[model samples]
Target: MDVCTLGDLIDVVGSPALRLHTASAGTGSPVTEVLLYDAHAPLPHAPGALLLAVGVRAAEAGPLVRAAAEAGMTGVVVRGTDGPAAEAEAHGVALLTVGEDTAWHHVHLMLAAAVDARSAQGAGLGDLFALADAIAAATGGATAVEDPRQRILAYSTVPGQPVDEDRRQGILGLQVPGSVDNSEQVRQVFAAPAPVRLPPLTAADLPRLACAVRAGGEPLGSIWVVDTGTLAPDAEQTLAQGVSTAALLLLRRRAAQELTRHQNADLLRRLLDGAADAATAAHRLGWNAVRVAAFALDSAAGVPDAERTSLRLLDLVRLQCDARYGRHACVLLDGVVYALLPAPEASGGAGGPEARTTADRRHRQLAEDIVGRAGPSLRVPVRAALGAVVSCRDGVTASRADADAVLRLLDDALPVAAVDEIRPRVTLLRLADVMRERGELRAGAWQRVLDADAEYGTEYARTLTAWFGTGCDVASAARQLSVHPNTCRYRLKQIGAQLGIDLDDADERLVLWLQLRVLAEPDAPA
Candidate 1:
């Protein structure tokens, strides 16, 4: 143990007046596993989280109170001493002074050691996160850990909508069960470089917001210091500060790993964005040549945040790369895995018959891999659609369009196991073919209408559009256009003359219809 009794620990950490514990046998366990300070819980509320001992000396009473506070004790019992009553009364803490007992010495030392032990066992920030949970589980109190930005990267008993992307983001939805307010309040209170009072969650709310943090001299994040009851001022601050420091040390170590992964993903995105030189991109990416494809995976309808699932699904793509093509960045964007396959320059060219065959062959294998690997996680099955690759910039655009098409088709037909099943070349091209067969110039026509609407606003654009589509047949067009025949004819002629288009042409009619559809959604195909 670090020190022999609560009296010895007082020198290291000042004494606390409010906390109390009963350690008849020195197991160091509190009377109960839960405590609530200033709470209106049922009376005869025997403390299950902490205990009060009768024999602790009056000099030892101070630290015992501190330890009880740190350990979440509601009260502690010590031998009657000159200052005990006054000290406890001043702190507004419930105090009990009893007779001396031998267990006080060893128990006190154990408490001190417990405080020092965390520092002795040095750990990095990431490890602190796990440790916080472990502490909470053992103590049955709440704990939370937050990153440098005060964002809770991870915590025990997370709120329903916890954000897991950054280690430094504030822990949103932390509902501590104490006088402490929300997660933000906790951070601001203890946010200093030195450990201090972290406004904790309330006793009731903490059942859910138990969390931890990791913060050292600078603080990478934070680990929680939680007990069911209110802590003694001195012990409370000390333990929270010590563990929080340890948590920060662990957080920094994991920071490097997360950063490398993000950097790789970013570099790959630049290569694919077509903003950089392809040769240099290929070389930097460890590719002599490459084939790229896109897959958009959608969570089953009515599912929540399907996009977040991309991280898990992305692993499947990684599995394929590992087994076949080798390691490469696998990116998740808009619910799709923008994947690249590395190949040799020799395997690339001929630009035709052979190229099509090879592309098709690799394409099918990739499809099979994606389809085979896609499955249920978190009780939801992932569905996917894929698009064909375009040569360079064109390919990127086409893949995006195709990826979207696959998503639509998933919305339309086939329970195709996942979004990956929608082969970009095939499924996306098939959509293009359907658009062609439907006599729609989705992009060309939509853009024209959009440009017009930009100048004309909604009503006129709608009026002109409907009139044009009806072929100047006032009555017939008016009925279809849902306007008076006179109005339809007038609008048509005026709009036609203004835009310089014949009110009766096949091309103009088609364009107007495409425009209506495109302007309606703006993001989707006509």
Candidate 2:
């Protein structure tokens, strides 16, 4: 497996978030964890751990750096421009610094993500940058490997190799620069049987030679190198040969990614189902949130290619949630996508009405954004429902239940809602579930009304529903049913007479309404 070194952490976090103050003996050490330094706590020996000296002053960081080095830590990150460089070098520990304005939590998250990403992608794939460097050496040009989406996976950093503005931007963003248009070139590269040369798209771009990497006739990605016209005589052959190796590496990385995804999904499933101890599962998954919220997403009804669309929506939701909440987990179960989002500390800690409200708003907004963004690409409407924020681990199941309830109650008119936003509907649905399970109100006046309509084709049940729905206003019911008021009144009288019930009795009307609601529920024994 690849080791995520202190240098990798700095590269991932970039400037402002973290900057190297002192490069010492352990600067290149593998970072296994990120820990916050506490003066009052016991100094635990954490080998290869990067310590964040949160609140430690520049002048006070000398001892922290010495302590970290003694504890086998990779480095100590302090807030300020200067740290004890001499002490760090003497102690053989690296000293890093972050801007005072940068939150320690953010830095911690970035470091964690960087370390996790390296561990996740390193299995059996070797080092992609090393491969890029070898290819660049063979081709005599700076090289970059990009996935099918044009995301830069790795690039050659061989010294003295010429690079253009596009390469620099692509490396910085980990994606192709948006200023250059290469759709046609990309198409040709993928379709070409062998290496193809592409003209520079802009004045700042150097000409490139690219070859599609394929395995089992499936395009995995492509490799590109600057064409400085100083290529080795066999540069084309060398790049073409490298394509086979790149394909294998990509295939391995993909397998590793899928395995990780499956493992995460299983853990999330267990958490949502309450099948595992919440705290244990959260710890195993490296989740540190004290509270979490659940979200349910599904495509709207009547969407063609529903299975494909659902999978796409699932990917979209997972991507969006990961981008927003770095520690989130999402899974698709039974055609519905569910996500468990950890509440950020800024939203307030695990309890209180204010915190809950803030978390709810954030979750609902995320859902709305997902739905809106999914529409055009999905070619059909999508809906999302959010559950109330609750304590993490054990409370996840309840939150998931709330999300499921809200999703079931959602309609085209209200594609997104929280449990509390539709509390009445959710309560009624819960009651309907109980009534159905108990077989109550399943074979009484409501059954007879349905039977009457089925047998005689009478509009008695429909008229009664319209009347009740319109608050017993005959004129409103008539308009709703698109019939005359006198006709609606006649149907109501027929319904009451047939059922042997008084239409004016408050108790009777209440029972009848409840039965209607229970029967209206989806799959409620027809």
Candidate 3:
């Protein structure tokens, strides 16, 4: 396995987010961990660690750099160039600067990717940068490898290579700039069987030759190269050939990622079902938190290609949660996506009286965000239910039960809701579950009403349901059933005489109403 050095990490995570500010003796040190620096917290001695000094002023970064050096850290990344470069140099530690617009989480993701790739080097993971360089060399032009979503995975960095502003921005942002209208170009490339020449979208953009990478007829990604009219005559042919290799690499990476997802999902399922030891599972999953919550998400009914939509939603939820929490567990069971989200309890700070409320609000917001994004991106209506915040992993099962109950009760109006916010409805749902288990409505007044409706083509059941729903007000029930008040009263009188029951008995009315509601459920037995 190749050791990921500080210089290598910088190369993989390019400029506009991170830039080398000062070179020192530790420039080639291997980066084994990524740490976020806190002034008030004690800094542990982690050798070869890269520190991200988020929210720290450059002028006040002298002590951090000295501390990093003393702790055998590789480098420190700050937001401004006014950082203590001299101190870092004297201490034999490197200093790096982050772009003002770049977020700390984004930097952490980039660094984590670089470090993870290095650690998985022995697994035959293809080097995308090397492939980009190879393609650039063969075609005599700058090159970029992009996923299907137009995310730039790798790009050639050879000096003196001609590249337009669009290419430069794509490399810097690791995505196709939002300003560019390339939907038609993407469609054309994916539909073509050979390399397609795409005209420049704007005067500032360059013409390109691109080919889609496919495996088993599924589009995996694409390769794009700048066409400067200086390429070999067979440049298109070379790109066409490179697609085969790109497909293989992409397939391998996807398989590895899928394997990991399955493992995590299996463990999450066991935890949610109380089939696994809570403490051991939590430790193995790296979820170190004082509290946790469960979120159940699913698409609304009658969605086209529901299975496919469900899988897409699962992927989106996992990505969003992983990006936000850095450590989360998500799984898809029975077409619903389940996520276990940790509270903001790092270092055991969430022990206050309002800790559960704070966690509920935070997790609710995230669930709402997921549902909101799913609508515009997947073109499908989605809903999410947040469970109660629990103190330990053992309580996750109950939280999951709450989430599942809320999901079952969700309607078109409520796209996101927490268990606490809908406790009454949840309680009714639980009661309905118990009623179903005991077959409470099988041979009761409700069943008799159903039998009479079927045998005589009567609307007795409907009338009774409306009567009870209207608090036994004859006029209101008549309006609900679209009949005269006398007709409603007549039906009620006949119902009492036919069933030999008293309509004035409070206990009987309550029990009868409960049975009627249970019978109204979609899954009720005939």
Task: Give Cα-based local distance difference scores for all models.
Answer: 0.48, 0.78, 0.77
Output the worst ten-in-a-row residue range by lDDT, candidate 3.
290-299
**Residue 374 lDDT, candidate 2, scale 0-100:** 84
The RMSD (Cα, Å) of candidate 2 is: 14.0
Candidates, ranked, TM-score:
2, 3, 1
Residues 281-309, candidate 2, lDDT per residue (tens digit)?
A: 55545554533333334433577677777
Q: Taking the candidates one at a time, how many backbone clashes does each contain?
A: 79, 0, 0
Error of 2 at 187 (Å): 2.2
Put down candidate 3 lDDT per residue, 158-252, tens digits, no spaces: 77779999898898888888743688888999999999999899988889999999988899999999998798899999999888888877776
Question: Candidate 1: which stretches are off by over 4 Å?
Answer: 1-264, 273-277, 286-289, 304-308, 343-352, 377-409, 412-503, 516-526
lDDT of 3 at 370: 89
Clashes of 2: 0
lDDT score of model 1?
0.48
Regions of candidate 3 where Cα sits further than 4 Å from its true position: 1-126, 179-181, 232-234, 277-337, 341-343, 346-383, 389-395, 405-415, 422-526
lDDT, candidate 3, residue 230?
Answer: 91
Candidate 3: residue 35 lDDT (0-100): 91
Off by over 4 Å in 2: 1-120, 124-126, 284-286, 289-335, 341-383, 427-526
